[model samples]
Target: MYRVLPGFHQIQQPNGSYFTVPDRYINLFPFKVDKPFVVQAFDRVMERYVVIKKVVLPDSFLDRQPWKRAQRELFCMLYIQDENVVNMYSAFTPAATREEMTEFYIVREHMQGTMQNLSPPTFGEHRTVKSIFFDICRGVQYLHAMNISHRDLKPENILMTRDGDVKLCDFGHSNMEDPNANTPYIVQRYYRAPEIICETMDNNRTSVDIWSLGCILAELLTGRVLLPGRDHVDQFILMVRFLGNADQLFYSVMNERARNFLNTYREFLENCQPPTDIHSHFPDEVFQGGLSGQPEECRMARDLLFRMLVINPDDRIDILMVLSHPYLAEIWDRNMNPDDIPQPQPPEALRNFFRFQNIFAPETLRDEIFNDLREFGERFNIFTGSKN
Candidate 1:
């Protein structure tokens, strides 16, 4: 969390309507997203402290394809640099196109919150929940080693800083597609993932992000909502009443209109009764309130939440066995492979353009984002962590 400044002496930064570069920075919550008041601002011209994201879009039918959902989250954070990913320094968007109506800010590095408010009464220590689930499973194992598919992992897209550390943030329903193409994809109905609901999901959609990181570590070890589904058929009836009926070749790629709604959820799980295991719905006070009264970290967090709450994405549990799960082997780091990590360089074809019916203005979106931060800052390595 890089602070240590009172610099930029006389102060300025808050003048608004963005990127003709006025606002010297300072709005701190006037609540803005579509109404556009403040997503937050504070630079005073690089005196530090950032974060002011936006990729606004509206006119909807099925999809205008909001510039391919803002180029699958700025090309998956411009090709996945890690330290648990989330950086983006600058991408002002005073321009407009793709059938007009645009606004796309991007200035990141600002945290100390979210993991959905670190579960219950603002979760503080308790041995930093295995180093914040080993920095969110090493940021989803560096986005499945770049094959990418963060189809929305939950816990409000995990962020945390006041020295806690976790990162992965909103890859607007990320891609590299095919997680068994059934279509209607948009996670977060209790972290969806029954092959994103039997459109017969096939393409190992990164095991539907390991079943939404085991429902975000079972809602940070029981701050509740391990499967609090309210839609998508009550999130497949609370995941078939807690990981129960799933294999008939997992609905043989469901397409008889979702295999007749998976045979009426297998006749409503054969008249509801036997279906609870995952330590009988985390009984012992949800592992004595998030790994506290430790019984070997609640028996390795109930065997890593039954191998990450699998209803079957080919029997989930991946992020490298969740970074060697022994309840997160104390933030393990077996030199995280993938050619010694830190990626993010291949992107240049018109800076990976995704036909948003070309329009642009603010001086061509500030000369194609400062020529993509000067050709990806002279090639790769832009991590911005240790608090950018």
Candidate 2:
């Protein structure tokens, strides 16, 4: 069920006494994709556009009290309110005064559009693409310091503002990178990392995001998906053709199911003449004239891409190294030094691998979300100008 109460802010009374202030949000439209409904709501009080993503709790799941499921995702989204990340304005379950509520709503600071909207011919300039990449790295760096993985990173989910500010949104597949738990199908098909597709446990969580970023950066620069695979098998073929095999060790470590896939594609691998050079695939024109075109900056950016688009997860560049890459100096912020940002204590690991299997009851989740905002306040001094 979806509901939008206009001017949720408190209001004044006709009498000398005052009523409630105006509500912070007002619903503009109801959007549906499949069964769940996502609403475009306005923050009447704040004067900002906000998106309310609905998380449905079916009767069967509710029987198990799956609050932890929703909690895990909300926790990840609300965990840190960083500028590079889409801010969670609030989270709550809808309950009428007379009846109990059934589902959850995650309210986010609505963005103008997504990075997908900026694909080439429209905004394919190199500097424009560079800005997009810088923000992505900044967001992932924060998640990595907390020992978390985005699990899913793609253009559609990366929101961008009118001023070129980017916000990484959608932590629906985020996790703490537990070695023990087998990762479900994580990233979207095109952006899926080789390690993730192979189901190799040897790779760490942060590397997965880096790999996805590599794919994203390539698309932003080239105005096309680097590897647009029709399926897992095709994806493997595409990667092998361009990046070459990651390592034989990646094959040995693969789980039985993944190994079987390689066996099926063995003939194709044998016949395929892997290209010796990848430079031709990313032409000089694509990097130079289209992007900033500075010879030194282009050289450094190409080098960074080489490190990120590695076939092996172990070979993938470290997330911190990306921030320091010389190519990014134009957009880099000296105050936001990667060395100065210490790791944060991640939220307590969700006891149940709920995966949004179950989550907080309305009041329970709301209280926790409010606490997140409060924690953000204490940590950043946004409210009292006091930092921890």
lDDT of each: 0.59, 0.64
**Every model's TM-score:** 0.34, 0.76
Best candidate per TM-score, number? 2
Worst 10 residues of 1 by lDDT: 1-10
- Kindly list the per-residue Cα lDDT of model 1 for residues 1-388, writing each as its tens digit: 1121221112222445432222455654433233352255567656776666656544353443454556456555655566777776665333333233344455677775667764445344345666787778777776566555677777767887766777988775665544444445677678777777666756346778887788777667667677776677777777767666777777786667877866756777755543456555565566434355666676677777778777767777667776666565555444243344444443443233422213443444434444553455345323221213
Compared to the true structure, candidate 2 yields what TM-score?
Answer: 0.76
Candidate 2, 1-388: lDDT as tens digits: 3343343333222232222212554554543333135556666545667776766544443343334445566766655657788877666443332134454557777777778774445443456767878888888877777666887899878888777889898776766666665664867889998877778774446788888998888776666788999987788789887766555777887888888869887766666654565455565567523464455555666777878888777777777778776667667544335464444443444323333333445455534544544454456433122111
Q: What does the lDDT read for residue 319 in candidate 1?
A: 75
lDDT of 1: 0.59
The true-versus-predicted C-alpha distance at residue 232 of model 1, in Å, is 22
lDDT of 2 at 43: 63
